[model samples]
Target: MRSALIVWGGWNGHDPEECAAIYRRWLHEDGYSVRVETDLQVFADPAIHELSLIIPIYTMSKIDKEPLANLVKAIESGVGLAGHHGGMSDAFRDAVDYQFVVGGQWVAHPGNIIDYTVDVTKPEDPIMQGIPASFPYTSEQYYMHMDPSVEVLATTTFSGQHAAWTKGVVMPVVWKRLYGAGKVFHSTLGHQAKEFENPQMATILRRGINWAARAEA
Candidate 1:
């Protein structure tokens, strides 16, 4: 069976533990031998190099050099990485290298917990297959600083209702990219575990995880 590691714990505001549980369940259902950890120290374990995927639910957390280096090295050597919202995008704000690996960093949420629409931009991509062309969602529509190289899968338009200057701006809602031999998947949704209860949001996240896991083998 494929193996995966879920490292969760950082800002409780994101309900990392709850989110990790949800991911653990789905990963197991998908036939992975899943391991869950609250401590970041596990990133340095020799076994990290053998995992098929890494799911990090850590938000706004600090990481020391040793473990962070190990995590990065593992991904670059073909381990897949997947995450969502502040838990991933906004994690390790002080670590620019981490942000680079993620392909984007969460900067702001203009209308925090407001209604918005996510427009699918790459319906043909397997990660987005079967999802609707567009859907309305209620959450923080993330405003991110993105890496230009990422393959964008979905986007949201800023109505400028909350931030006037952002009116009519289109921002990526979901994306996938590569860091060396590894596949990296990210979505700017899921402020909390409840967001995944939305069928569309949950499907997208699950599909993204599957896509990332296959990047290596």
Candidate 2:
């Protein structure tokens, strides 16, 4: 049986606990033996290397050097990593190593909590296979600084209403990349657990997690 770890704790404003529950349910339904943790120390635990995937719902928090290094090493050794929104990209703001593993960092969210559209960039990709070409969404439109080599599966266009200079700019919303032998998947959706109620958002994330698991890789 495949094992997965979900470490969730950090800004509670993102509802980490609730998001963790959702992820746990999904992992269970998918037949993974899921373990959840609320501390960053789990990153340092050697057990991480034995897991098939790691899902972090931690946002805007500090992770110690030793733990961060071990986490990176585990992933590089073939463990998968996956998460959405700030929980993944916005965590460990100062850690370049974490950013390298995640493939992107959340820099800004113009017009916070507003309506926007998500455009499927690679519908043929398994993570986005049945998702619509474009779907209306209501949440923060993330403005991220991303790794150039990551494969983008979905994107969103800024209207320039909030940041005029950003108007006409397209940004990646969902992406997957390889970190050594690991498969990393992320989506700049789900500002909170509620967003998961959206079928498209939920479906895309579910598929992304499955795609990122070590078994799939």
Choose the strongest candidate by TM-score.
2
The lowest-lDDT stretch of 10 consecutive residues in candidate 1 is 208-217
> Tens digit of lDDT per residue, candidate 1, span 1-217?
8889999999999999999999999999999999999999998897798889999999997998888899999889899999899999999899888888999999999878999999999999988989999999999999999999999999999999999999999999999999998999999889999988999899999999888884343
| Residue-level error in angstroms, candidate 1, position 56 | 0.3
Candidate 1 at 210: error in angstroms? 0.9
lDDT against the true structure, each candidate? 0.92, 0.94
TM-score per candidate: 0.97, 0.98
Off by over 4 Å in 2: none
Name the candidate that leads on lDDT.
2
- Tens digit of lDDT per residue, candidate 2, span 1-217? 8899999999998999999999999999999999999989989999899899999999998999999999999999999999999999999999999999999999999889999999999999888888999999999999999899999999999999998999999999999999999999999999989999999999999999988899932
Off by over 4 Å in 1: 214-217
Error of 1 at 53 (Å): 0.4
lDDT of 2 at 119: 98
